[model samples]
Target: MTTTVGRISLAVQLLCRAGVRVLAVAGSANQNWLASLGAEPVVYGDGLEERLRTRAPNGVDASIDAFGDGYVELAIKLGVAPVRINTVVGFLGARRFGTRSDGGMAAATAEVLAELAAMIAAGELIVEISATFPVEQVREAYAKLAERHTRGKIALRMR
Candidate 1:
């Protein structure tokens, strides 16, 4: 969760906070919801490239690869500079493509965390949860995550 999908979610929030336009690549289930968060939605899979181009006709300024599996390459193909691309999951791809292989470390800081918390507290940043599991159900929690269809974070409760 350091700089993976979790980090991508935060990055999106940061962008929205800064008023930067975002093109979020999500599945049909989450597309509208992502749009509600201020990101223009680009559905993942078939026609992804075309959709991205259509959404950002002026060209993408940067990229964040959370799901890996050739996205680093896709971002490169879309004309984003290697230095502007940061990835968490596509380590090998980042190395190969010369993209920054950071786990969202550039955006991490105590002040930022406090700001994010405030955003949530103020409802400025929408926090979606796919599931909530007790600490004892950690296995079940992980199983749900492995399904790869969650639209938001899954919570694990200590109690």
Candidate 2:
């Protein structure tokens, strides 16, 4: 399951393209958008485990938690192996549960970046740009990012 914002859109796209059935856990506002990208969006909050079970009766193959709040445990509880579970914001959870906390670093190879860039250029991938601010507006850009509801990257344009 994934969060509403962050790199969830790209994750969903990549997973869907790989023939994996993506069950995206997002906020209500992003549910429809996630669905349009071939994911079954489940609203995140209380009883998320039950909701996820209802969607994937057989169980999930793996899980990635971008908004870590006990999600590492939740993924383990959902039957995902520790090695297959990765969290971007759950370093403690990763250490405690032996899960991977390797986020961008693990997947940021030049070849991978080139592939993603090619997909974006070929219209096979979509990178949602939540907002763009001039370099002078760095503070304002961070303020917007701090709100935590941006759909994607809040770019700081170098002007």
Candidate 3:
């Protein structure tokens, strides 16, 4: 499952565009939102490894490690080929790959955002809201995230 469910929609959209049937690991949001974006949300109980092993027995086509470090290493272990692997922030132990745009990450991020917006406009993606609290409650917000398994985002209001 993704550590940040709020951002996974872009990944799912990209995967769908590439004709891949994606299975997302939604660690903090309703599974339906991901499904609506063309990914099957597989809950990663215990740990990511356990979920990967159970879901992709023959190894995954590719595993992108957005979480970096230990996560990238685990993705490498599960991928069938080197090209089927990469990470947003380069990890120490994994092979580095070029992103879609050579204009650096900012450009790629923009592209992802465009895709997300398009999906939202088309009513193909749904935003999942877990909770919202005043800025003064930031500590409590973090505590709640640490203590429970939420199905969506925990946002702080500034005004």
RMSD of each: 3.9, 2.5, 5.6
User: Candidate 3 lDDT (Cα, whole model)?
Assistant: 0.59
Residue-level lDDT of model 1, residues 1-159, one tens digit each, is 111122256667768767788888877777767767767777788878887787777788888888877888888888888998888788988989899988667767999788879988998877888899999999999999888778779999997
In angstroms, how far off is 47's CA in candidate 1?
1.9
| Tens digit of per-residue lDDT, candidate 2, span 43-143 | 88898889988888888778887888788888888888898888888889999999988875778999999999999999999898999999999999999
TM-score of 3: 0.58
Candidate 2, overall lDDT? 0.82
**Least well predicted 10-residue stretch by lDDT in candidate 2:** 1-10
Order of the predicted models by TM-score, top scorer first: 2, 1, 3
What value does the lDDT take at residue 13 in candidate 1? 71
The candidate that achieves the highest TM-score relative to the unseen native structure: 2
Tens-digit lDDT track for model 3 on 35-102? Answer: 77777677654676777677766557665544443555565556535555555544454544322211
Instruction: Point out where model 3 deviates above 4 Å.
Output: 1-7, 26-37, 41-58, 66-70, 80-83, 87-115
lDDT of 3 at 113: 77
Which candidate achieves the best lDDT against the true structure? Answer: 2
Quantify all predictions' global Cα lDDT against the true fold: 0.76, 0.82, 0.59
